[model samples]
Target: MSHTLLNESNADQYRTRVTLLGTAGGPPWWDGSDRTGISTVISVNDDHYIVDLGEGWGPQFRKSNLGPVGFQKGLDNVRAVFVTHHHSDHIVDLPNLLLLAWHNGSDGLKSPIQIYGPGNRGELPPIFAPENREQLPEVFNPDSPTPGLTESAAKLMEAYALDINDRMRDNAKQDLRDVFEFHDIELPGTTGDRPNEDPTPEMEPFEVYRDENVRVTAILVDHRPIFPAFAFRFETADGSVVVSGDTGVCENIVKISADADMLLHECIDMDWVDTLMGPNSPKPDANLMQHMLAAHTSIEQVGPQAQAARVKSLVLTHLVPGNTPAEKWQQAAAGYDGDFYVGEDLMQFGIGAPRG
Candidate 1:
């Protein structure tokens, strides 16, 4: 569909509309007008909330035509950003989004853009320490010592300090420091522990953020070894929309999405993936396959879960084989009875109503 076709008629209805910014899983690799990284914009009334700012999201957002002409003015419409996890594919565009949005201010942005996500994992013991007797310290070292989202954002800001200073001094003349408010989603007894090994203790869904227009609640999903990955549900006066950031077939998402107006869930076609990593090809390492199967939801799992959730409509996104033929997706949805769509970049859905 043409970007120009996404008119503001639904926005005028005072209902929520979700636009698929990018639907490709993993990274941007396909050749023929294929999907970008996974990103989705959920607009409630006039306020816009972004879920997962994957790679290429900036260009995709512009293509959606939801913002104004100028760069800053266009991004100024985004009220908050919710990240499901810290995976590079899911958050690669964060720095770009933060810089551009801050540079382009809008009258509506009275406060910094709120960013919510999981806290960091516990630091691994130093190499050569007693804990390293059984394992090679250098090989098992932690990715970084950062404790959580708050520190991660601070570090990102620190990395761009010089550029930020230069821009404020010579161009925008605004302190970019005031442009973002970061929050780490923490659960009891989870701090200072390895996320995958010490998952958040099972708890009921809880509010992550709220404003005049919408309320977002989060449920911990089983993306094992990644630790504390989440699926969020946004509720407004018009309807509720749920986003399954990335996960295996977890009941948490099903519970959170129960009776939701729309469910946007991630899906993988493992068979297709295996074909890509062909039989003659060296098999993926056992550990890698374990992580892939444990972390991602298969296509067969989607329909049954959505059926169990009783969602009014289902949109499958973050596709594993992003270039899979449309007919294959139909087969994937064989058990789902309600409205179903194989999402595409720039495809828009109006909540509380049918897919547009």
Candidate 2:
């Protein structure tokens, strides 16, 4: 089926719409790809909630035109934020959002923008294939090796104390403490106890947040070693949208996304992984290659996963490598007949019927 491009001009028809802020995945600056980073926004009428704060999110958000026009008004309507994981590619620009909010109209925020993310892992993950290495690398922060969103934000604020103080006292900006609040999403008591042994246990989705406009639920996904990685489902009155944060094909994803209107999933190009890390490379590492494939869903795997969920539409975002040809990515439509789209930055998808 031909893909339909959704945008703001036709957004009036649906009660809820989602905009792709930046679709690129990973840390490397990909060749021949201008895609910024991985980020998205689910807008309900006038308010919007953001997911992930990847690199270049700030500029791309402005280009999206989701907020009101004029000075310092870009993030005025950002009601909340959800971080799927602690991957640098997914949250490197978080400082941009937190620090720049003062200059970007966070003062106009109706209430503190609630930020939610994974909590601290009580212990450090095991070293991957440790026997081969001569010596183990020293732990970076011994006391608090794996700080979660709440602690991470506190440290971030501490790091920027000089600048934050300069802005607040000299420029007379609103207290950032009053503008934002951070929360570490608590996992279900039964599961998530064994992070290294079983990072993603098969379990039903649980509520993480809810408001007047939408209810959000989360489930653990198989992004191994990177424990607590999640996939989020946003249910609005009009329809449901699920974001499959970085993960391999897992049953929990299909369970959370079951019957969702749209599933915005992450896709990796296995061929690229093979070329870079396969045996033919200068120094092949089988463990590294397998590790990459184990963490992300490939193009061939995504459609079947979407099919299993029975979603009405499947939009591919967080394109791995970020420079792969669109024609190659289109191959993902195989095995599924739903409306499939290769998401581009700033593109919008409205849910439910259009206005008369």
Candidate 3:
């Protein structure tokens, strides 16, 4: 396979900070259940860019001290959103995110946001199938078990709309027709729209966003058959961090994460999941969750990725079974001999200790 991952410079002219909202695939109810999906917010100064608003956003985002105007002003400060791929566990809250931003644009969420990702236009509604299948090459891989890049966000939303609507109760009244603007930012070579149908988009690999403090780079990784899966590397003046969305033993990821100060990767504690789910459990089904395991990375793989990249620390996110009730984060440290952090809802990590 052609690899595009590379070493990155975490250096910057200004400082940047990243925050974790919901870090598990299943929820993480405060009382202790599992349904909240993965969501993270990166803030450069007061400007915050919310990424992958999984399930628990309603409650988690509420944790922000920034009230209605806080959300709206923050939304106004956003630069753009870079999505890893389209998984309900990863982005189901996006529609709600837009709805809230639009509905509250005047007070809470500054509307007309711009989002970039692999699916059709901005996150596609799950069920979308173009009349011509060839148009979307990033999302469809017949050889893999999952839909990959081409999974229609529109279609997926349709599949889960009922469940979502039920939770929204009566408030699910609005139709979010034009909440946010969308840009398809795949790596070079993926879009046939360019000569010769390459797998990656043709845009500049690394970007200095509107804030300009942090540099972002997109790299293709192997979450195969899920066509068009990705990993992003973020660099700030203080340090660098790499986010591995979902993948299994991908060499390209090693390249993208190379030398970053920290790496946050999605992990499946295979041993834990196996022991917990057992043969009688109702999951790992032909349904959405089961399909994810085949292509996802396991904990066994994360340490090595960190070691190879020589990152200062390794953090784990988007965890399945979320290592609940079991010192999973500490256990992960056994794999590598460096600092490791496990993400939780509303968990905050900064460059250094909070001021005294």
Candidate 4:
């Protein structure tokens, strides 16, 4: 059945929108690529909410017209951030984001903004390194001395807050404590296809935080060492969309995202890489590509995954080398039965209603 789009009768539509701001490995540093690493901007009315702050992301945030003001309000509604993990590509840009958001001339947020992620939950795993161990403190809970990821996360928050507070004071901006909040989501299963992508990982299932009209669910999936990679199932008033962050072939995704309207998943070309590596005299560069080949989900993995989920459309992202030409992208994704498109940065998809 087709779901109805959610309408905020009290507010307006242009109030919020979702933009795929950055779609690269890390924010463009020297390559001059338009994409930034793994970033998504979800705007509600005029305010924007950002996901993941990869390296060099500051420039792109300004470029996307997400600078400060929203379409209606002088300052964007964007006051909150969600970080899925601590991977360099996923969070290296965070400090800059905090600095940018608190820029005096902008919103001048009165309270610390909320930053929700998995790492905010339990104690850091004993396996974490010393430098990162402090950053990944366990969440604070006097009731439970149980050293967990959250405890590690708490230590990190305290340290981060101390530093950030100093900067805010220097900038003469509002105290970050009044402006920054950290939330943690604990994903249950461990020690399987999923490992600690990092003590501070990215992601929240579709279910956790959403309006009545929207429901999100998270499922365990395989991204090999990128362990604990997620499959986000977004159910709206009208339809459902599944975003498989970055993963290899896995069964949990199929069960979680059954019957989605669209499945936007990352894609890599293992066949071509294999061909390159298999040749008698392989290029030295092919070795690295070969490793990336292992964890990332392959094109061959799509058809079956989508079919199993019964998705209506498929959008392939995180493209590997051969996706240059439209035909190549289409051809690469040809295995799937549904309508498919090659995704690019800033491409928009209207989810709720059809406008005249």
lDDT per residue for candidate 3 within 1-356, as digits (tens), equals: 01111111221222355666677865443345443678776655555666676886655755643223543433455556777876567767776755455344343334445676764422222432344256654545334433333344444556667755753576643344344566555445443232113333334335524446567777766564444667777766556667788777666777887777667788777665565454555544233334355567776667876787777777778877764544765566655776777766665556422223
Highest-scoring model, lDDT? 2
**Residue 170 C-alpha lDDT in model 2:** 97
Compared with the true structure, what per-residue lDDT tens digits does model 2 show for residues 83-186?
A: 99999999999999899887787445668999999999877989988997999999998989999999999999999999999988999888889989999999
TM accuracy, model 3:
0.68
Instruction: Quote the RMSD, in angstroms, for model 2.
Output: 1.9
Q: TM-score for model 4? A: 0.69
How many residue pairs clash in model 4? Answer: 52
Q: In model 4, which regions exceed 4 Å deviation?
A: 1-17, 26-33, 43-49, 66-76, 110-112, 120-167, 189-206, 211-213, 275-294, 321-326
Estimate the TM-score for candidate 2: 0.97
Q: Rank candidates, lDDT, best first.
A: 2, 1, 3, 4
Superposed by TM-score, candidate 4 places the C-alpha of residue 23 at a distance from the truth, in angstroms, of: 1.9
| lDDT against the true structure, each candidate | 0.77, 0.89, 0.58, 0.55
Best by TM-score: 2
How many Å off is the CA of 274 in candidate 3?
Answer: 2.8
215, model 2: CA deviation in Å?
A: 0.2
**Candidate 3 ranges with C-alpha deviation above 4 Å:** 1-15, 26-31, 66-74, 105-111, 120-179, 190-211, 275-294, 352-356
- Model 3 lDDT-worst window of ten: 1-10
Better of 1 and 4 by TM-score: 1
- The positional error of residue 94 in candidate 2, measured at the CA in angstroms, is 0.5
For candidate 4, the 10 contiguous residues with the lowest summed lDDT are: 2-11
